[model samples]
Target: MKRSLRRALWAGAVVAVTVAAVPVTTAFGAGTVTTTFTKAQDWGTGHETRVTVTNGSSATVTTWRIEFDLPSGTTISSAWDADVTSSGNHYVAVKKSWAGGLAPGASFSWGYNGSGAYKAPLNCTINGAACGGGTTPPTTTPPTTTPPTTTPPTTPPPTTPPPTTPPPNTGGKKVVGYFAEWGVYARNYHVKNIQTSGSAAKLTHILYAFGNTTGGRCSIGDSYADYEKAYTAADSVDGVADTWDQPLRGSFNQLRKLKQLNPHLKVIWSFGGWTWSGGFTQAAQNPAAFAESCYNLVEDPRWSDVFDGIDVDWEYPNACGLSCDTSGPNAFKNVISALRSKFGSNALVTAAITADGSNGGKIDATDYAGAIGNLNWLMPMTYDYFGAFNAQGPTAPHSPLTSYTGIPQQGFNSDAAIQKLKSKGVPASKLLLGIGFYGRGWTGVTQAAPGGSATGAAPGTYEAGIEDYKVLKNTCPATGTIAGTAYAKCGSNWWSYDTPSTINGKMTYANNQGLGGAFFWELSGDTSNGELIGAIKGGLG
Candidate 1:
């Protein structure tokens, strides 16, 4: 999923929409506390915001406060993770009552809704220190130790950490992962992490997501991010700096280098996500033309060697996603047929479709079976069946593998969708099960069991309702298992996600069902050591 689409996919319509923020650091006291303000969502007249506080100093901080002034015509409305008091356009926020002290290198974040378009907070101060880290007298002492010397590379580095374990076994199955283009932004996750985390050694294919479909043609999403930004010598994948006039740079160059390191990996360009699905209806109108345009874009001479083929992730054909699609049942099959015809049998032709298994749901609205002959593999997004999108929660696992007595919705689990597609004649060998590397959670919950009540979305470093599995593993470890998944209740926050054990169980089920393989939503969500993907490989073996 792309940035906006992932936000919307798990958080729902109103919660979708996010842009990267340039972090602002505060200087003055012993512990330098930095604050970053990000526009989580913007809707013309109003926007939601998140403020992150990072402690870079040696000492631990028991408490903190932030003060900022909004420009005229803008004001604060609602807030989370902090208590706010406003005087005209100026607002002061104190740490939330339930929050604990911040340790060195630790971070805390709070958010609010404000009027007018998203704007940077002016005259910002964190714990009485200038947010921009000006040369001010010591109000408090900060940073007892010298700052770390190495800065993370903007581009992938040439070095690869030795594998901590033996090479992963996929058992002739594919371990596909999606790498979001925008992850190089605020996420600070570059292709280098894939190598260092040992994921590159495990992955059989990497799907580069969201090459835009605009004007009914395949287009680049961000030119600078895709192939324009230059990489320094230290950040270059081959340890050679990007030239001023290189034909390719940015992520394209980095991926090309990554492919060199892992010859077994195939990269596929995936277009159309929740935010961009609206364009599919138009592309579906002329499947042959659409396929031709995509063919040209994928085989562009500049990066022709970087990709194997294409994967169309149109949200839905005759069904609904972020927006409803009225394209008849033939639209999807027609598009796939045209793509296979153009790309030929040598290239990989795949797709990602809805896992809705209800009778007459999205699965029943399209001609998925007809496209089988033309496609190499089809992925059923088995996750996101339920989330904090509905604020009041009956607290359920988001990616339940099987049905339970109190499942909120019938036929919403992973097994139901897989079985439904199999019944429709979609060969198990051509169907890959989808797993989300993140978790969906809610706050203000009173119970610990699956059935519980929640007031709203749980606070997250990036978005409200969702968080990466890497953070969730350490912050809120799972307490119990249910429906072949895991759930945890830490303090008042409740989260549901698949643990390594659960993923192992799921993978066993996948192998037993004679399925093709298992693919995750993306790679950035896994631990720095690639724990989850390791489980996937181990279980598949």
Candidate 2:
């Protein structure tokens, strides 16, 4: 029965979107620009405006463009950029390109000369959101003539302790940074930034891969392949170090070098994913052997030092994975217990569990709350509900951090998942919110804005009709927030994703929930300057 259920879930996730008239939006994995306009200011004379755009999305905004409809009676005259244009009242500001992209947390400013008194535009759009009304700067006052008469009192001096060594900066958050795995394949350039941003100093763990599984015989899937590519690529970098390096090539080896660069970073091997999870059933049949195999593989003398922990990513145990196993409700807990007994707490033991919270859905398949007490942290693979996969549908939400109107997949969103886990007995601090680094959508969509669907699945490298979060922030920003997540439409396509704006909100939610921290799917999927990670840090702050 479990095996059958797992197979059904896998079948559901693997199927392509049915053909439809509208274009389907991509999944929430890539195409999220972290940079957003936070606060905007206006100065007179073509009014110099100050806009605060922060990087919180998965990727950086290399060249940001701020466009808004200007008020009538005002025309852009002399401009600092000098290349901006005025379409009636509409004004568009483009980066010089030479300034390069703004790094995460980094801000950029430009001013324009225009006619008429400076007044905020009636309609304002910053990073695609309706910013409401413009703010007015406070007035400054001139000096007054009143004189002071009171004198200061004298006091005794105090002695200080003998000069002792000072402690390090030690930031408030322990796990401030985590590297997602997808970056190993496509955007391999960021491994260095992870090292440079002092992220290594603050980072405690790294989670690789978006969605994949323990294929036949405990073998991994495409995510492993991507990891191999990234591992090999790191070898090309002269003097680069990794924490999980063995003489043989792999992310483990590359991570070894990364650790050498920053000894604090911990690399853990995660198995099982949203796809290809059927193998867990087979492994569960011989949990002891499977656990032994994992121990040997992770602790192999060559790269043993690099691997500080092991994470079981079985989508769910006993219940089902991408495929199912009939080992009974206790199968998942047994497998995890076996792993824990074998590896012990000296090495980290963690897992990513199912977020579905329905009465008899995936949540009931296994004992999540019961299992979490023994593990260090529980990561919930949030996001990816309404995409091309459900083409020709009442568009459901994939990763709604919270609940909202028109959410087809009501209880399955992130918030419900976390709440359900907590209600089941999992401690809030033991939980980590999982944020998608990409967007999910279907092409051939017909609706111009938010709620719409595609006639069928659109083309994609791994999954049909889904795209990375980095790509969609610019292509299809959410018209408004749904639940805690956001959804938007571009042309006929419909998309669900988190932007720098929404990520900030998610971070706040995580802090409010007392979650251990947040984790994204893969690292390479984010922008070059490390925007998403920056948001994670700032949000924690």
Candidate 1 vs. true structure, TM-score = 0.70
Off by over 4 Å in 2: 1-193, 196-202, 209-246, 448-450, 458-463
Per-residue error for 187 in candidate 2, Å, reads 5.5
Q: Per-residue lDDT for 262-295 in model 2, tens only?
A: 6556677676655656767777787878888778
Model 2 TM-score is: 0.62
Q: List the residue pairs that clash in candidate 1.
A: 27-133, 29-140, 29-141, 29-142, 30-140, 30-141, 30-142, 30-143, 31-141, 31-142
Model 1: how far residue 516 lies from native, Å: 0.5
After superposition on all C-alphas, the RMSD of every candidate to the true structure, in Å, is 26.5, 21.7
- Per-prediction TM-score, please? 0.70, 0.62
Backbone collision tally, model 2:
93
